[model samples]
Target: MPMQAAQWSKALLADALAPVYLLVGEELLVLEAADAIRRRATTLGYAEREVLEAGPQFDWDNLARAAAGMSLFASRRLLDLRLPGGRAGKDGGAAIQAFCADPPPDVSLLITATEWSSKHESAWSKSVDQLGVQVVFQAPRPNEWGRWITARLASHGLSASSEAAALLAERVEGNLLAAAQEVDKLAILHQGGRIDRAEMERLVADSARYDAFKLTDAAFAGDAARALKVLAGLHAEGEELIGLMGWLVNQLQLVLRLASAEDFASQARAERLWPAREQLFRQALRRAPRQHWLGCLARAGRIDRMAKGRESGEPWREAERLIAAMALPRGSLSAP
Candidate 1:
């Protein structure tokens, strides 16, 4: 049955009667669920656990040893095998088959790895499916991201304004890592209490990785086309032109911060500005001038006016004009 990381505990209430359970996925939350189950089982008297991580030089003999070893500590033994590559080799496969043919009494074997494509699922995979529970992990969809965020917040005993959640869903745009970071930030600041939209606005607006943060790179590179391309994507996403202007201003601020870095390694110190891509920002500042930021902001202002006015014009064209002005050298264009 399909299950989310948060729901695994409920599913396991009945399924825990089984001696073994398997989890597989790239989602970090899924992996954490698998670990939680293993710990719970360990507390419930399944001792003598053995974990095999599949990597170079991993051999099948370990499985043989696990199956054959007499439990020195507890009545039941648990094997948590992590095969990131998804299958064992010839010798390993045979060992696995033998273990499944007649798994020792009170010995539970759990397996985990990345999911295999239909055509690529290994024989051992089928064998494991027939023998035990298999939990597969898939990334949450766009609609599901909001639910995941809410679930995560509740898991920590927290709540948020519906507007706050809505804005988070809007700004983060289904990026799990970004969502996770935002959740963590809120959790800490609010102390697991209620979070409001004002707090969300204060903390997160532009996606640090891609959103309005990227303006100057396009400008400094003198590629008006690329600058406009970035703006076009943001515009298509329904971002307000004023919102873009605000982020552009923030990016200009980062340029000032970057220039203040004392030396090479001080690039790390520059993290205070962007905090997300300090190294990249430092590199961009190497060839760009602090004055360029003011220039970019001026151009962004004109674009904002065009967007707010009844230009009856494509926002992207105004964005292109903005990029063109920003891409030129500091004095290349007069101030707005």
Candidate 2:
């Protein structure tokens, strides 16, 4: 079985290190997990490190050669293998399986991939799991972001109210690296003081880029005025209609998924929704049927074409109409 990312720290406390370890998933989390593993290996006297970038043209034999050859001065070494796109082709898989079959003494192999899903699993990964450790560092879901931010703030010796954390979560929009940077900035600016929502708003940079995400949230929350205001802001800032439509379409699709489910509570849990976001979706579903969201999504495609010059119409006007249809009550939308 693969180890949970949260359990990795506790596992590192063990006296002995595994011969092979694989860390995969979101880039920031994967990088951080790899860093922790490297630190632990260093402390255990793995004095030498060799990095191998496993790109499409990489020679799989190099892994074996690296295992066989270590610096004369260093008795122990860490082999860092980076799998781009989280795939090891047949040859690469064979090489990894061979390595696991007879892993060299005094050598630790750390494989890190920046992306992964159920499809990424294979025999070689299973081999690593059997011999050592495998971890998937999943990003927090949209609803889980606030809790993650709160925990992260705590790590920086800062305390924030749930509202403040939720605000920060909205600002970052599931970008872990951006969230980390914002938390670091707050720690410096606030000196680890307890922060409120208003203070958080005042302290964080006003990132116009994430307004697209907020646009959908506003619509979901039934704040038509706020949603339209954000849409206008995005338009004035020269944000691409297609870019904005991308997130809008994604969210509408999620709503369709939820609305179509026979069991909403179970589906929400499967989607990893937190209570706040769950409430937002609940209200959205109540206000509009799945067919309504489907219509909006289809309209979004037309806007995409308009933006791309393949269709006739003002994409911005169409986008505003779409937002209004989503944000307003069932009979409240006016013709554009």
Candidate 3:
């Protein structure tokens, strides 16, 4: 059965061992679930751990081989498989189904994917569903965030008044990773005492002031200074680089799609540009040529690799450069 992240702990306590587990989501909840699974597996005698990243060039045979192989010392092994693109092509699908049909008793498979659309419900997913557990991690909604924050605080042996929890929720703005870090910081600073609104106001920086959408808006308005400021603020606030890059890639793709239209009016209509944002899009389109946006998209891919530590050089500096190239006036890209 598909389970929510909140249900994972209790479920694990009830039945900690499973032949296979599939985790799908992009939120930090996925990370927490993975950690919980690992901890429980460790306790259940899955002493050997093997991790594999299934990327474009990954071989499906390796998955089969790993499952078949046995650990030299440990009787039981844990297989941690990560599919970054959340896809198993034809070959991968077949392998997954085959494994599901007769999973190795000595090994436990924990498969994770960043995305899972309707198209992902293939034979492999169905096999996993019938054979093991599937969990989906989603962020809490606005109405649920305060309670989420309060629970996170309690985990650290810290309590907060309702107002303080709401303030913290507002400050983090639904970013669970940021909220978790803030809760940890508060636990250290307050030494596990109750927190109130005034202390929250004084201690918590307004990291929520700049989000990906706001940064994109600033860039689309050709406000290079403001965009750069937001970029710095988000980085300082410990915002996830992958989330930031994903937004930039999406915005650039939208612009590229519209730029190919017959005229500005047609493009605007195709993009469903609201009256408030039409001018901003127009200004953005005018400031740079289509080729510039294409280059930005290409660089966004490189920045993603950099952020993941797959490529060398500083990711943040490259991100700043990409933002300036897209957001600044064409000739003023080198401006301080």
Candidate 4:
């Protein structure tokens, strides 16, 4: 049976190392889990480690050879296999089963997959699970990010209040790698002191890329092409779809209010919109009616559900459609 990656550390401490260990999950978590295993294996006298990349054109025979070959540097060895897509072809599966059936003495195998799901499991994976250990690491849910950030900050000898952690969580979105980097930076800047929300806001404001906010600005400014580029940039930078949707939803709600308001100037002042943003909304509201923004807001909610895995559509693609709807005049062009 497979285990949660978070439980691996405790399991490692309680039990002896298995002859083979398979780790599959999000890239950062999987890499970190593999690193932890490597560290433990090293301390247990598995002094020599060899890496094998199982790419599309890789020879399946190499696994068998690695198991049969003697280690030159140490009595015990580790075979670190990198299986990028997690699917072992028929020959690769057979080779793995053969090695597991009568594995070489004192040689451990560590297989890692950065992309994994139930569909990626195979006979080879099951064989390893039967004879060894398999751990899966999943990215935290949207609501779990703040707690994760708080714990990570503690690990770095820094403390953050709940609000501060939540702020960082929102800023980093659900990207664990980026969150880790930010925590490291904060540790250095604050020297392990407690981080407040204001400090986090400062960091976020300073680091805020033009792409995130500009995505909305571009859409509001009736530039669908620029919005698409900005959205793609945010995606490339590892910003979670849900995070992008959060701001998009906010903008849509603001537009709805502004569009429906009987007194636009008073409402803008009440909402504390800056002069520039008020002007932008005034221009955007002119291109489309209140009903249009309402429709877009409804679509945004659907996108958010998709982003959170509650719906089936591709959130990114749906987001692109939403941007097109907001940026272009009604009936000017259909969403691609």
Candidate 5:
């Protein structure tokens, strides 16, 4: 059966051994789950380990060879297969199915992929599910995030109030790795204490690494200073200019769509705007007309070209100009 990372502990305790294991996700949670499996394999006398990374140039026969080979040093072995592209192509699928059908008793197969999609639901994946265990790691939703943070803190022998957990949820912005790291830091700083919002604020002040969403928040709030500040921070942090431009284009398109709608509330619902963020979009709508927003998006497109070397200008400078154009007062537009 397919299980999440949280259910792994109980599931592992109940059924600790399996012929094959498939872990699929892009989050660090997968790493934890894989570590658990590795430890259990070691405990079960799979003392020898071999890793096979499948890539464009990978040979499918190597998988069959590894399974059939015997370890000279150890009686039992662990075959760790890393599929970065998440799919076993035609030959790989056949090889995997063959291995699953008659897995070597001395070898325990551990497979990890960075992602799993509908297209990956091939016979190989099905064979693994039938023969072994599959664990998937999914990110928690916004409302469920506070509880996640609380549980993470409790795991480190630390606890936080509901307000503090909420603050942490906001600071990390749904990044589980960041939340886990922050909990570790808090455990060191304030061990054996119940954390509150003020303490959270002090600890998490510099933790807010600027991202596209934060940049858009400043621009939509009409704070030219903060918007430019965030843009500079992003550039300094080595954020890709093309990704930032994509975010700006997306947000401006949303604004353009909302502006054209007769009922903005209905439009917001259609756009799936979170309740906390709807006010920011509405404020941005009031700040600029549809034409102006379109112009900003057009400028973003030019920046995209510059980033791809299709144009002849500095991309970062162009992005700063676009952000300034969006955040400036209503009468600030002079020319293209």
Candidate 6:
């Protein structure tokens, strides 16, 4: 039913046998998991990978065209229908349902959605999970972020000393996308396999590329001047305010998770936390209020929606508001 991202074979899973591959989740890892599924399907003679967006404007017949033509390149074909949350809707949903009712028996049907919620149900996600595989790319919590960071670095065939690992984890927290990037940069600077603390501190300490991380650090430290400076610079550098708020939310969540959990091992057990990130989590726990992260999420969500053109907010000003709130001392924020 639920398959680990690593356990599922991309090629085998993408073969012509499985008709529906429903990748469900909003997490970056989940998105990458879908990418893996697609790549594997390529090896199994899946010649086509077309994206069909489902909206009122979309044509039901176009859904069929995703795999309509016979491939001169290969026999097997892949029809990727980017569903409305990977669920069947009015037009394409029914077409997809019909296709599933009596599958093409040749083409592999792949469906992907942002987040799999408990609310909606449709023939598309159902069939995908039943016939195909659901690779979970759940977001790693703050506690687990460290472990994931370690594994990610290890995967790149790189190693960091225990202290360096902890520092990196602290600096990056549990944000995998950011952590992965840091790893990539460190890998580039590392020259060889070994990456030490001075190197990590030197690379991460720079606020140019990773201003948000630095800003959050300043916010936690209650250094308003530093936080504002980073914020203004980040804004100038084309960094979005809502995005920074999102990063703050992520850090806060990790801190709470690590603090509440029985031990640092919870991060590893629950979210695959790394050995080096314990101190960072501990430090975060000490500096910020747990609710600050949640508040940041709510605010960021609204700001993010507005910025996306889905809702309304002066994006730049909203970021200033968030930064102002974040700059407040941990003991300062109160229940609202």
The lDDT leader among the candidates is 2
**Per-residue accuracy of model 3 over 119-225 as CA lDDT, tens digit each:** 77788888888898888777788899899889988877888899999998987777655576567556655755688898777666444433565577767766678
TM-score of each: 0.56, 0.61, 0.62, 0.60, 0.60, 0.57
**Worst 10-residue lDDT window, candidate 4:** 203-212
List clashing residue pairs in candidate 1: none
Error of 6 at 259 (Å): 43
Q: What is the lDDT of candidate 2?
A: 0.83
True lDDT of residue 112, candidate 2: 95
lDDT string for model 2 (164-202, tens) is 999989877776655765675566578557899988887
Runs in model 1 with CA error above 4 Å?
1-7, 15-17, 205-336
Best-matching candidate per TM-score = 3
Regions more than 4 Å wrong, model 6: 9-17, 65-68, 72-74, 84-87, 161-163, 196-199, 207-228, 231-336
lDDT (10s digit) by residue, model 1, range 198-264: 8778656444334454455556545567577777777777767766666666666666655665653
Per-candidate clashes, comma-separated: 0, 0, 0, 0, 0, 7
lDDT of each: 0.63, 0.83, 0.77, 0.80, 0.79, 0.63
Candidate that beats the other on TM-score, 1 or 5, i.e. the better one: 5
Clashes of 2: 0
Clash tally for model 6: 7
Write candidate 5's Cα lDDT for 1-336 as tens digits.
Answer: 677677778766743468899999743666557767877877877778888989899999999999999789757888989897889899989988999999998788899986877677788999999998888777788899999899988877888899999998997787665566567557656747788899878766533333566688678768789789888987887877877777788888888899899978669879876433555666678777888888887888888999989999899997888888888747454445
Model 4, 1-336: lDDT tens digits are 898756777877734478888999876667667767877888888888888999999998999888888878757888999998888889889988998888788998999998899998888899999998899888789988988888878877888889999988887667565566567556655745677898777655523343566678779878789788877777777778887788899989999888888878669878976444665687789798887888888888999999999989898888888888889957443322
State the RMSD for candidate 2.
13.7
* Model 6 error, position 81 (Å): 1.7
